[model samples]
Target: MDIRVVACDIFGTTVDWYTGVAAQVAALLPEVDPGEFAARWRGEYAPSMDRVRTGEREWAYLDTLHRESLDGLLAGRPVDEPTRDRLVRAWHTLPAWPDSVPGLTRISAAHTTAALSNGGFALLTNLVKKAGLPFDCVLSAELAQAYKPDAAVYHRAAALLDVEPSQILMVAAHKWDLDGARAAGLRTAFVHRPREKGPRQEADRPEDVTADLHATDFEDLAGQLGSR
Candidate 1:
C-alpha cells in the first residue's frame, strides 16, 4: 500500500527518552551515577505497564506510571518532593533524536505525519513543543485508556485521523508495537533505535514481519519512505 500518513510512537522510537531521562536523573541526583540511575529507572517500564494493561489497576498515562516507578526507585532518598516533581516533569522535555526533526519535516511535506504514542496528549504536546517536533497531530493510547500492543490504540489512530488503518503507517523502534499495528491492519515500518536501552543494551534481534522497511532513525525512515 502507498502510505498516506505516518504515525510514530514517541518514547524511544522518536526520541532518546532513556538518555534524556538519565540526563535529568543525573542532574537531579548529583550523589548518584546518572547512567546507573537511568538504567534502574528504565528497568521498571514493563512491570509498570503491566499494571495498567492487565486491568489490575486503572489505566494511567506514562507520566503517572513514571512517577510510580520513580518513587520505588527513590528508595527513601532525601530528595525533596520538588526535585522529584521536576524529575517527573522531565518526560515532557525530551531532546529528540538528531534525525527526528529533519526526517519528520521531510516526511511531513509529502505525507501526513503525527505521533501515535502511549504518551498522553498533554505530555506529548509539551514534548513536541519543547523538542520542536513537526507533527501534524498527536494521537495517544491515553485517549483509549490503554497502551500500545493493544489493538484498541491502533484502531484509535485511524478514527482520530479519519483515515483507514491500511493507509496509516505505524512506525516504531519496537516490534511489539508494529506487530499490534499489523494485527490491527496497519502497515508497519521499523526505525532501528539501537540505543533505546542505552549503551550496549540488547536490541530486539528479530522482528515479526521483518519490518516493511528498515532504517537507523527517522531520517533513514524518511529516505527509504521518500517519494513513495
Candidate 2:
C-alpha cells in the first residue's frame, strides 16, 4: 500500500482505558464492583455516540457524552458532583499500553503519525500529553462534528493531513473502526487488543477482522510496517 500518514485509534488501540477507569471507580465507589461498573459505563459509549451520529441530538464532545453516560450508569448510586467530575476526567488520564510509547515512537520516526479518534479534542490532547504518546498530529472526530463509522471523520482526517484516503493507513483495535476507514477509502490495519474490555471479555482478534495488516500490539504493528 502507498501509506504515508498513519492514523491511529486512541481508546482501546493506544491506551488502557479499562484499567484506568476501573481504578477510579474502585476508589470512588467502594460498594460497587469497579470492573462491572467500568464496563457498564463503556457500554453507554455507542448509544450515546449514535444519538449524535443519527442527528437525534446536536454535536457534543466526547467528554460531555461520557459525563452523561457516567450519570446514567451511576443512577441511584451515592456519587457526588466531585466524584462524577473525577470519573469523567479519568478518560483524560488513561495510561498507555506497555508497547504503545515505543511502538508509536518508532512509527512516528518513519511516518507522519496522527491520532484519529472519536474522542473530543481536549480529551485526545490530554490523553496524548499525559501518556506521552508519540504522535506528529492529533485529529479528533470533533473536527468533523462526527464520530467514527461516519465517513466524514475519516475524510476530515485525510483532508487535514493533505493526503489521499488511500495513502493514509488507519490503525485500530476495533473492526468497526477499520471497516469505517476502509469504506472511506483508507488502508486499514487491525491491531489486536485482547484485554481491552478486561480479562473476562474476549477482545477482537485478527481473524475477526479484515485489514491490510494485523498484529498483536503496537510494537508488532511497527515491525510489520517496517518502522525502525
Candidate 3:
C-alpha cells in the first residue's frame, strides 16, 4: 500500500529495548548478568501494558510500567533504592537501534514520520530528544486514554494528523501491533526485529495476509516505500 505518513512504535520497533534495559540493570547490579536481568525486566512489559490497556488498572503510562517492573526485578537483587530509581528512569533515555537514526532520517525526508506508541507523551518526547529522532509528531495511546489494539488510539492519531487512515501507515515490529492498527483503518508495514524475541526465543513475525508490506527493518521498509 502507498501511504504518505507512518506512525511508528518506539520501543521494540525502533529501539533495542531489551538490550537498553539490560544495560541499565547491569550497570546498577554489577553482579547480575545484563542479558538475564534485562530479559526479566522486559518480561514485565506486556503484562503492565495490558493493565493499562484492559482497564484493569488506571491509565498508567509506560514510565510507570517500567518503574513497577524494575521494582519487581530488584526485589531479591542487591540493588539499592537510589540505583533502582535511576535504573527505572533509564527507559526515558534508551538508545535507539543502530539503524534507527539514518533510516528514519531518510524516510522522514519524504514522509511525515511520527510515533504512535503506547508510551506517554512525556516519555516519548524525552526519548525522541535523547535519540535525536526527526519526527513530525508524537502521538501517544495515552492521549486516547487507551492502548494499541484499541482503535480509539489510532483514530485519535489519525484525527490529530488530519489524515484518513488509508493514507497512514502503521510501522511496527509485532504482528498484534499492526493488526490493531489495521483494524483501526490504517495501512500496515511490518518491520521485523528478530532480536525483540531475544536470543533463542522462537516467536516469529505473525502470519497476516493484510499487512501491506513487510521489511527487515527501517532501511528495508524505506526501500519498499519507493519514492515520494
Candidate 4:
C-alpha cells in the first residue's frame, strides 16, 4: 500500500445521505413514505448524471440535477416551491457517519485526504463544513466537467493532487465507483455501509466487491490502512 493520498467518495461512503434526506422528507411530507421517497430520489442520481456524461445534456452541477430529480419525484405531492427547494438543499448538509470524522482525521494524519465526489464544489464544501469532515482538499466531478465512473473525473483528481493514480487510494462504498477508479489505475478500497440505501437495503456488500481493501466502515478502513 504505497498510497500518498486517500481520495474518498462523499455521499454514501463518508456521509449518510439516505438518513439525512429521508429525515428531511419525513419532516416536510409526513404523508409520503420518506424511505421510498428517498430511494426514488437517489435512484434518479445516476441516470441524471449519465445524461450529462453521455452528452445528451450539457454539463450541470449535481445540485441542479438533484433539484430536477426532486421536482419529478414530488410531482402531484402537496409540497410548495419554497419547501421543495429547502428539501433539495438538504443534500448540502448530510451528517457524517459515526466513525467518518474520526477515521478521516486519523487517515489524514498519515495521507493527504480529499473528497473525490460527483458533488459540486459548493455542495461538497457545505456538506464537509456541516459534517465536520477533515478533508485536506475537495475535488469534484464538476471540476472535471464529468461525473464519476468516467475516467476523466479520476484523472482530474490525480492531476490536481499532483500524484500518480497508483499512489492514490480511491475509497468508496459503491463497487461501480471502485471499479472505475481501478480502471483509471488507482488503488481501490470498498467500505460497506449496509443501510446506505435504507434500513433493509439490499445494497452491495463487501463480498460482492473486489478492491485492494474491504472494510466494514471508515474506522475499520483507517485501521486496515495503518492510520493511527
Candidate 5:
C-alpha cells in the first residue's frame, strides 16, 4: 500500500494488555483470577468511552476511565487506594509484543510511524518510553476529545500529521478500529493479536475483517510493507 504515515493502535495492537494488566492485578489481589479480572476490566472500555462519546460525561482521559473501571470492577473487594492507583498505572507500562519494537523500528526507517491510540498523552508517552517503541509521534484520542470509532479521532490524526486520510494507513488489531479508519477515508491494515485479551480471545483474528493488508504480527507487517 502506498502511504505516507503508518499510524498504529497501541494497546492490543502493539502491547499485550492482557498479560501486563493481569500481572498487576495478580499482585494486588492474589486470590482473584488475574486474567479474568483483566478481561473484566477491559470489558468496561467501550462502555466507558461511550459515556464520553454520547456526551453523557465530560471528556476524560483513558487513565481516568481505567481507574473508574477498576473501582467498579473491584467494588466491595476492600482494596486500598494506593494499591488501586498502582494497578491503574499498570496500563501505562504494558510490555510490547515480541515483534513490536523491531517491526516498528524497521517500518519507521521507511515511513513515518506514530501511535494513534485511545490512550491519553501521558499514558502513551510512558508506554512508548517503557517499551522502547519507535514512534515518530504520539497521537491520542484525548487530543481530539473523542475516542476511536469516532470519525473525529481519525481525522484529527491525519490533520496533526499533515497528511490526507487517503495517504495515512491506520494499523490496528481491532476490526472496529480499521472500520472506523476506513469510514474516515484512510487506508487500513489489520494485525492479528489473538491473545490481546487472553488466550481465548478469538475476536482479533484476521478472518473476520477486510483491510488493505493483514498480518499475523508486527514482523509480518513490516515484511509485507517492504520495510527492512
Candidate 6:
C-alpha cells in the first residue's frame, strides 16, 4: 500500500495514561488504590463517549468527560473541587512512551504525521507540545463533533490532511479503533501497548488484532514503515 500519511491514536497508544494518571491519583488520593482508580476512570471513557456518539447527550470534549468521570469516581472521597480539577488536568501532562517521540520523529521525516484523537483540540495541543511528539498536524474529534470509531472522525482526518482514506495509515494499540479506521478505508497498524492498562493487566496483544502491520512499539512501527 502507498501510505502518504500516518494518523495515530493518542492516549494509551502513545502516552502512558495508566502510569501518569495513577501517579497523580496516588499523590492526590493516598487512601485509594491508584491503579484501580485509574482503570475505573478509564472504564468510564468509552461509555462517556458512547453517550455522545449515540446521541444520548450533546458533544463534549475529553476534558469535560474526564472531569465528569473523575467526579463520579471520587464521590464520597475527600477530593475537593481544586483537587478534582488538577486530577482532570493530569491527562494533559501525561508522559509519552519511550518510543513515542523517537518513532514519531522518524515517521514524520518520511510521511505526513497527524495526531488523530478523541481529545479536544486544546487538550491534544497541550499534550503533544508537552510530550514533544513530532507530529506534523493534530486532528481531534472536536473537528467532526464526534468521537473515534465514528466513521466521521476518521473521514475528517483524511479530509483535513488532504488524502484519501486508503492512503492514510491509522495506528493504534486498540483493535476497535483500528477496525473503525479500516471500515473507513484506512490502512491499519496495530502497535502493542501491553502495559497501558498496568503491568498485571494484559493489554492488547498481536493475536487479538488484525491489521496491515503489527508492531511492538512506535520505534518498531517506524522501522516497519521504512522510516529512518
Name the top lDDT candidate: 6
Per-residue lDDT of candidate 6, residues 151-182 (tens digit): 99999988888889999999999988999999
lDDT of 6: 0.93
Q: Least lDDT summed over 10 consecutive residues: which range in candidate 2?
A: 199-208
Model 4, 218: alpha-carbon shift in Å? 1.3
As a whole number from 0 to 100, the lDDT of residue 89 in candidate 4 is: 91
State each model's CA lDDT, in order.
0.84, 0.92, 0.81, 0.92, 0.91, 0.93
Weakest lDDT window of 10 consecutive positions for candidate 4: 199-208
TM-score (C-alpha, index-matched) for candidate 5:
0.97
Prediction-by-prediction clash tally: 0, 0, 0, 0, 0, 0
Tens-digit lDDT track of model 5 for 95-124: 999999999999999999999999999899
Model 5, residue 84: distance off in Å is 1.0
Clashes of 4: 0
Better of 3 and 4 by lDDT: 4
Off by over 4 Å in 1: 206-209
* Local accuracy of candidate 3 as per-residue lDDT tens digits, 1-228: 567788899988888777777777677778887877777777788888788777789887777788888887777766677887788777788778777777887789889999888888998999888888778889999889888878999899889888898889998888778889889899998877878756856444645435888888887777777632
RMSD of candidate 1 to the true fold? 1.7
Q: What is the lDDT of candidate 2?
A: 0.92
- How close to the true structure is residue 76 of candidate 3, measured as C-alpha lDDT? 75
For model 2 the local lDDT of residue 162 reads 90
RMSD of 3: 2.0
Question: Candidate 1, residues 1-228: lDDT per residue as tens digits?
Answer: 779889988888888887898889878889987767777777787788878888899998788888888889887888888898999888888889898999999999899998998888999989988889999988888888898888889888898878898998999888878888998999988888777878756655444446777777887788888632
